[model samples]
Target chain A: MMEEHKVIVELKQIATRFGDNIVHEKLDLKILEGERVALVGGSGTGKSVLLSEIAMLREPDSGEIELFGEPITQMSGRELLAQRQKIGMMFQQGALFSSLTVLENIMLPIREHQHISGSLLKDLAMLKLRLTGLPEHAAHLYPQSLSGGMLKRAAVSRALALDPPLLLLDEPTAGLDPAGAAAFDDMLLELHAALNLTLILVTHDLDSIWTVTNQVAFLGERRVLMKQPIEKMVKDTHPVIEAYFANERAKRAIRQELI
Target chain B: MNEEKQPPVISESSDGVQLRGEWTTPYLKQLQKISKNNTRHQVNHIAIAQLDPNGSRVLLELIGNEPSAWPEGLTKEQRGLLELVREKVGPVPAQQESVNLLAALGQQVFRVIRHGRELLEFAGQLSALVFSLIRHPRQLKIKMLLDVLQRDGLNAVPIIALLAFLLGAVIAFQGGLQLATYGANIFVVELISLIMLRELAPLICAIIVAGRSGSAFAAQLATMQMNQEVLALKSLGQDPFAWLVLPKLLGLMIVMPLLTVLSMLTGIGGGMFVAMVQLDLSPVEFIQRFGAVVDPIHFWVGLIKAPVFALIIVNVGCMQGLLAKGGAEAVGHRTTRSVVQSIFLVIIVDALFSILFAQLGW
Candidate 1:
């Protein structure tokens, strides 16, 4: 995928505090269109909060969020939603609508975001499901019946249903077996290749960072520790990043656990 | 220190890794079991200690390979649970043979009532939560209602119908047997009519709705609570009550009455079928007698109770769901509480109605 210099989302001096507990402070990042950046950190380091704020799921008390060259912090409810539609997000737990069949899950983005008819939405949903290596029959079946991997794939399919320019995945490979995680990685790569999606993945899964993502960002201590190529990230000398990479458990188990 | 020196030489079965790892060999079985049990026990102790930190004096290592392995929010809570485990277990030895089941049951019953009191109070306070959410309708609220009601309320219809059918059958069979003995088979019509229209119809329907939808409501809100979606909505200048609670309350308020009528109609239909075929009554006479005997006032009374039952079901369901703490287990627990409380409240409301209507010369 060709990297676009166009900054689709930019966070400048972002800070979020939950009462006395300050999650992130003065976090800064520029996500270029068609850039695949994996945000990695400790659990309490506010990776999800960073992603949520950018996604307009949360608003920082201070700092600015610009999506598609528009100031997101200034955008109202209707406008934020309009921006959300253009950006696809795969929730940490797959977050497939439990009420919906896999087909319906995919169709939801279409139903909410566009003017497509139900049948056409179904066809589009099936097509997206296929791209994730899921069969069309998986479409009609509800989420509870699905295996963890199948549910993630269905969510991925749904995320792509609206043909979003930017796709944000929160721990895309978590709760999956190795084969499932690997398969998910392949599916992500395939989607990136096929759609040229500007991907922002918030994950602590180092394996995913190394194997799947192109760029990596580390968030911690109220700031972005680093944002650069994955290769450069692993080679960086930051103590927190070093401690993370040095942890033996991370090498063997943390990838699967964190995903 | 020699025991801890090997870093707990626990090894996974290389082959068993492909499956859920139940594979065992006789030679190494004891070692595996020892390590596995020890690991689980240690984990439990640590988690329990986190829930109730004073339970264990020995500090366990905070043993996550990475930050993601453990819940960040649960450390303090885990300490509290551990400390309470000692409190919960009491000083009584487990080997005691003369343990009183009733006493145990009584303690559980007492705790439940105590818990239930706070819950009912919370149910009353839900309108305040609703009022705060009215100014803004956030996505989280939208998602919660849409998921809970659609996933639970709509999907649970078949099971509710089945339960109503079975309740009707049981009543018809028992009523038929008693009436047969008295040589008053015709009076079974009046009995069935009275019990079902006035009491069983609403009671059974309320129970079914609570069991099915109440639990779902608790789980959905609980998960949202866990994720801070409720907080997120508030931060985004949206009010969760109007967005989430009001619509669901409205939807359930609408759906429950229709369901009550369905239950009443279905129960009667089931009874009528058994009456005609099993008891050898002519269909025309059964219909005419059923029509003649049923008071229009009973129908109104049944309709009237539906909203009250709805209030119980929706209120308890949503209330308990919102009250969910911790993870999936808390959700399940809350769901159970919601259903039980919903059913209890429904019956109590029904009884109050009965008392009031009786005193008013109904």
Candidate 2:
């Protein structure tokens, strides 16, 4: 099955450490084309760090990362940038440039990579904004003026500006109300289907894990403890996985069929 | 795919235009140019061998949905790509509004006035907090006060000493060169002493502190503000001014005069060292000459400006920090603003002191 599908990202024998504190050791994961994958872990389990590694924003201490079948280390600077343009990563806090309006923020990556005219670029950016479910007027407003939900959606619009094959989201539903999170999850599903994007999100939200992702990769003890479909992974006997899935809130979410 | 060499080709036919070659992001400029001339012309065929998502969107945007036409022998993959593009790229309503320069300028002026008013209000509140703290002495956090003093003052000494010493040496060396031509080498002591005591020492120390502690204060407070710790304090019913700003104010004020005195001594010592080496004057001779020519009034004049300079540095730093909003970038902006404002205000205050002292004939 893995051989049948094209692998978009492959991390092999990845090791990351800061001084004496090892975050990841000999970790390996492969994400196929158009897969919706979630990275879940405890507070210090380096889920976000792993996400950064996949995004090429950070380099592993020792390992190799291949994006679209091209080894990242082997690619020239221009080729590497071209590869990076195929992947869009949103930071935990939206990370929109505060100086630019929502429209300008979304247009930034597009303008950087594409040579379209200003008016057409604006139109393309507007299309992205509309796709993310943001109102037309939101394009004029700065990130600071937007609510938490709008900001996240705006960030999604910016990430989608280049129409990347892979989208990495760091805690997409964090700090959102349940309804807002659910709405965001629905938007993600719509975007995933429409754009044919491969998604890798690092999230602690149990509801998000169930609602958004098909596959969950649990990071613990300096490696991926399990990578399986969410349904099957919930029943896994791994100590950390068991504890995570057996949590009170997890149980509640499961009982409500919200996950 | 040698994208630069493969500039997208537009073939004009009797029916319509057929776009060939790779239609990717790099070729969007060429596509836009082609579209500009043929805006009225219908795109009857898209025979491009490759089309990325961005390229597909551009192509669909160029070819508006009309009485339909498709490329002959179009592959299923190409059709799928076109379909995706049609689904995503809808008619984009153009933004027509132009910027009004005069209105923008007016808004900027209003923003500046509002900022000035806010700064004045902050100063008033700070004064009130200080007055209340004086009345309720037990409310002051002595531990935090001491920590700030040690951090902002004692830790500043090494840098201050080095800068002051170097500046003094430069002044002495420069003065000695001019003085030596006139056989007035001894007067270099008077020049160095008077300048170091009355102006250079205090000015340099204040500027250094502004660069060091002022920027640090702004960055610290801005980060706290960004993290909502300041809001947390407000929610907890604790005045952040009393806990944070007042200690910085007090710590800086207390240390500035002391640092100024130390700066003066170090500067004079440096001048003496330079004079001994360059002018062939003994250390004893330099000291004696300095003591004789430099009056107590000059030292007092410089010392009197220290607390005022300190107040300016602390207030500007704290004000910038308090005004900071948003993220790490906001903190950096506030820090830069704090240093610039503190240095500007310190120089202005120093000039005012100079004028006042001259009027009083000090």
Candidate 3:
């Protein structure tokens, strides 16, 4: 079992509901500072829900979610928003507003949080855009003008505008080509190492599990399947673990190795 | 067979990944159940809104199986009484009474003499937006103008013409009917022809444009409000009122009078058709009388009121659209509200104009 006392994000029995449907049960979760945790699960297994819940878009019905020891559930809208400004989230759809220019989109959060001159704001926007490896010239173009891979990269740049300490990315490599996804993973690793940013990634990509993360949290049927380092996680015996790894695709690959 | 019954196929077909067919079967059944319920619920909702309880009960008997349609129950009744009413009313005939020789004779006279006072209202209200955009124009420039003119001018022409023509015909018909009671049918031609030129045709045309384009602008703006695109601008630290509402109001104000004039022409033209064919009136005699009936003030009066109509259309429509809530649905609601309110206001303003014009006795 992994040690859990040094927690940056701590949820003590969090419960959240949508109308009457329970999205999250009395789920207890924690992520330490600098921890690279991969939240893995089946479809509709509350992986994204838990991530967004901590992001504070949807409030928990009962129990508390703490960020850097500050209780999130108790914060007011302005305070909650201030707390959110400290955390960066790359959404599943790269939820960049469709109408804004790339530069305007990046500058939106920065200008909102800080009062600065237009030239200084432009410089800041250009720096963030360059960090994501996009051309500075692309800043003037609209979101509809970009390709899917470019969109995610642009979204990542926007998410990092205020240089938030923690980054919560949902399906970072979901729709990328293998080469693009690999490059993205490397970029993420570089950003994480450079910024000392805590990355809590939610994904189902088995390749990402082997390639990217240091630790893993398996959210299965109702509770955590295993919360440990990746190497140890594969060795552990859990039904979800067995089912995830024991697919015919793995067996077929092994059989094809003989050919 | 039992192995097949166990779902999650992951078949090695042409496609790399596949779930069992049965996996989708249950989901489909749920979808079908949902759609059926939705159809039923939508029908019911629309039925409830449009039809009397007696009529709604008759519709409920035809399609009411809840869970089979949809769960949240999409609105049912939008297809309400329109369908039933259409069935009951049968095939509508072309408007025959729209044309007559007396109306034709009257329209020729009304055109030169018309008091187009509505144009002034359009002028004052339209300039506000033009002045604002002159300071800081964006992608909103030509598109807003084209949209306003196309809707106000082009689409409104036929309806306005039809209304003017029909009004001229009605004046001739009604005046002729009364005068015939006293064996004064010849005087009916003079009375209808005189009224058509001096006041009726231009007034009717202005009213039609006011209702059509005015309400259209209101509804359009109201829908914008509902979409929250306007709110999104404010969150980005942009003023939606300056960026959206003002320019549109100005566009409508500038564009409405030209369209209103076109509507009057069409209404009078429609009247001319009736007058020429039904009243045995010559176009030459109609023009001679029309020239005699209308003075410059009569035509100017109708044109003067158009700016007011345009102003109301833009401000009111935009306000309603801006007030829209929730999402696209709210946009639709406010759109209806804007159109209804704009048309009513246009009529009220026209009525006030009538009272003022009558008081001046020009």
Candidate 4:
């Protein structure tokens, strides 16, 4: 089944660094179409940095990135922009523009990329807002006025406005309460199923990993130590992966797994 | 993924209308125009080659929200997407209510009154903190005070000197022309010294400081308020006013008089240069006349207003900052208001000082 699907993102021998501090080295991973993958690691392991690299906001120090089966280094600026329009990235802190209303924030990307007019643009933005479980009233309020959960949902709505097939999230559930996190996980799964999106999210929440992601890419030392389903990843004896999941949450998940 | 696909198109059919092609966002740009122009057909069926959520939404909008209008032969994924978008199609947000003129005027009046009240409360709280800190002076943040002094005071010297010198030169050249024509070129020294020491120096310095340090204080505190840094300091049992607001107020108070003195010296020096070059008066003669004719009372009168201007500037800046409510836009708005209000208040206070000094026969 994996072979049948196309590879959406391929990173080969990727390396990133800041001065003397090395974050990723010789990191190689392939995310297939319609797969929900999570990049999980300890702090400073550069999960967010890797997501940024994939989004083409930042270039790696070395190695090649193949986004949608084309090498990014060789693409022209216009081609890069065209390819980038197919990818939507949501930053960790709901990086919504504070000045624009939530509805306008969602409409901005679509307006820049498409030539749709006034009523159609608003209707499209409103549709995306509803799809992310945001209420109608939220569309008129500024991002600063919304609560934490609503802000995250609003950010996701803006990301989905352009209907990008690939959606990247950074810490989507980090600050949410337990119930909100669970609901967000369900929303992600539903969106993935309905929109057929290939998702790559950077997160540390084990519950979100189990509920939303089908593949877990564990970062350790300076590379992806393993890539497998969460059920299998929890059983791995690798010291880094074991140390990461040693908390009580992992134990409860394992006991409750029924496997 | 970068490959270009067929743009969405609506074709006329006997039954209704047919949407054909990849109905994705990038491709739907053209379909909007086509759909708007097609008046003859009711969109009854959508048999698109490819469909995303955006495409499904456009299709659902084209056909009214009737489930019966869902075309046949839609793949399960496509059907699920259409249903999801259609189910969530809520009414557009309501337009803002139109406010009547009398109510708006009343709101404006109430807003000004509330603003004044809040400013008074903040001023009271700040004064209470200052009084308590005086008894335990060791509690004062010496390091932050020094930092603010270096940034808001020492860093502002160059621009202040340049403006003061230019203003003095303009006054001397203009005054010397009139004084020279009357064969009283020596009185240019009295004119320059009196105005520079008593009015122009202090007023120019205060205006510059209000634009510079006042705006900075407001923007810095407003950004902190936005990021919850002020709240964090409060939660830690530390008074944000004491730590954040007091340093700026005290630093500006300490530096305003020093900057005014610098302004007076540069302005007088500029006047002295113009007198020697343009009025044919020597520096020694100009200094002698300045000391004999310009009373020492003028200098004191100007110096006495520095701290008051500082007080006005710091209070307005910190008040606007602490009251900021939103995000980046609020920070910008508050900072602009801080500068404008400080300058306005400084000029009004200066005028009041002039009247009081005249009545007192200073």
**DockQ of each model against the real complex?**
0.02, 0.40, 0.02, 0.73
**Top TM-score: which candidate number?**
4
Give the top-scoring candidate (lDDT): 4
Output the lDDT of residue A67, model 3: 90
In the range A1-259, model 1's lDDT, one tens digit per residue, is: 3335878889998888889998888888998877789988887888888888877788899988888888976778887776777777889888887767777787676666554345434544555677678865676677877889998888887877766678989988888988889888887886676555789998766777877888888876778889888667665688887776666344545566877
Q: Ten residues in a row with the worst lDDT in model 3 chain A?
A: A115-124
Compared with the real two-chain complex, what DockQ does model 4 have?
A: 0.73
- 3 against 4, candidate with superior TM-score: 4
In what order do the candidates fall by lDDT, top score first?
4, 2, 1, 3
Sort candidate 4 into its docking category. Answer: medium
lDDT tens readout by residue for model 4, B1-362: 54567778887767766777888888767767666677446765667778887777777766656766656657787887888888877667896888999999999999989977876787788788789889888768999999989998999999999899989999999999998889999889889998999899999999999999999989999999999999999999998988998898889999999999999999999999999899889999988888888889999999999988988888989999888996678999999999998899899999999999999998
Candidate 2: where is the Cα deviation over 4 Å? A1-30, A41-46, A57-79, A217-229, A232-240, A247-259, B1-30, B33-41, B45-53, B67-120, B179-186, B234-237, B273-294
Q: How does model 2 score by TM-score?
A: 0.82
lDDT of 2 at A4: 34
True-structure lDDT of candidate 2: 0.85
Location of the lowest summed lDDT over 10 successive residues in candidate 2 chain B: B65-74
**Residue pairs clashing, model 2:** none
Q: What TM-score does prediction 1 earn? A: 0.45
The global C-alpha lDDT for each of the candidates, from Candidate 1 onward, is 0.68, 0.85, 0.63, 0.88
* Tens-place lDDT digits, model 3, residues B1-362: 01232321222345332222222211222323333344423322111212221122223333442334322222343243223322322111222356588988899678534423333333444455467568767735567567656766776767766666677677767666666578754454456544554456545654565456555655566666656666788999976665666656656667666765665565455555555665656666665655675465765776787777667667566666555554455556666766666677767877888899889996
Query: What C-alpha RMSD does candidate 2 show over the true interface residues after superposing them?
Result: 3.6
Off by over 4 Å in 1: A1-3, A76-78, A248-259, B1-362
Q: State chain A's TM-score for model 1.
A: 0.91
- What is the C-alpha lDDT profile of model 2 across B41-116, one tens digit per residue? 6666767866665666666656654315554534676666667556655544455577599988998999989877
Q: What is the lDDT of residue B21 in candidate 1?
A: 20
